[model samples]
Target: MSDSTDNTTFDSEDLNFDDFQLEDFKYEAPFQPAPEVQRDLSFFKSIPVTVTLEVASKEIALGDLMKAGEGTVIELDKLNGEPLDVKVNGSLMGHAEVVVVNEKYGLRLVDVLDSALTGVGH
Candidate 1:
């Protein structure tokens, strides 16, 4: 049989922590500024992004669409000479106007999305 005596056991009433000061628990750690990180993101310029020029769109009944042929001209919601929406990776990036360059179709950027709208820098 083990002896029923143990000096390591503690009793809540016997402990007194009120005499210790708060400064006694404090540790002095060295203070230093964190090092800045340097990164090379030049490869971001080489990333490929899909750009699309949206002209106009119209929704018609399935029956009407099936009946229409190449000669059919559907009226769009946008008016003539309106700026086209420029999309990058299926996201609205800016607005542009259509132009003809060397007998090829091209778009001239009229307005670009501000940083506040795209949340670029933020």
Candidate 2:
């Protein structure tokens, strides 16, 4: 007898492909919480509120503005060395000084203006 193995009977039909049914491959989604979950509001009672500053400005005549060439001064509502007005939602809220923090420039709140009215529109 010669010492050789001739096993060539393996083919696609030999495997049981019908065992993998469509229902076995179906995916089941995980549970999710309802959209209308109630949340507690007591934590927001002590939150600090602040006002912002907004500068009221106007545009000068085009002829007057264009005449502003070299060394010509164009005046702004604010004066020199005065802290820039800080406004929130188009209303003056406070004043701040320009400061540098962590290699980046930011505003340092210096003063907060008192509201004109006690309870009504500010």
Indicate which candidate wins on lDDT: 1
- Show where candidate 2 strays beyond 4 Å: 1-59, 68-72, 115-122
Model 1 score (lDDT): 0.83
lDDT of 2 at 25: 88
- What is the lDDT for 51 in model 1? 93
Clashes of 2: 7
For residues 1-122, write the lDDT of model 1, one tens digit per residue.
88887679778998777867866687888997789766665566677989999998888899999999988988998888889999888888898998999999999999998633354322
Model 2 poorest ten-residue lDDT run: 113-122
Candidate 2: the clashing residue pairs are 52-86, 52-87, 52-88, 52-93, 53-86, 53-87, 54-87
Instruction: Return the top candidate by TM-score.
Output: 1
Q: Give candidate 1 misplaced runs (Cα > 4 Å).
A: 1-10, 15-38, 115-122
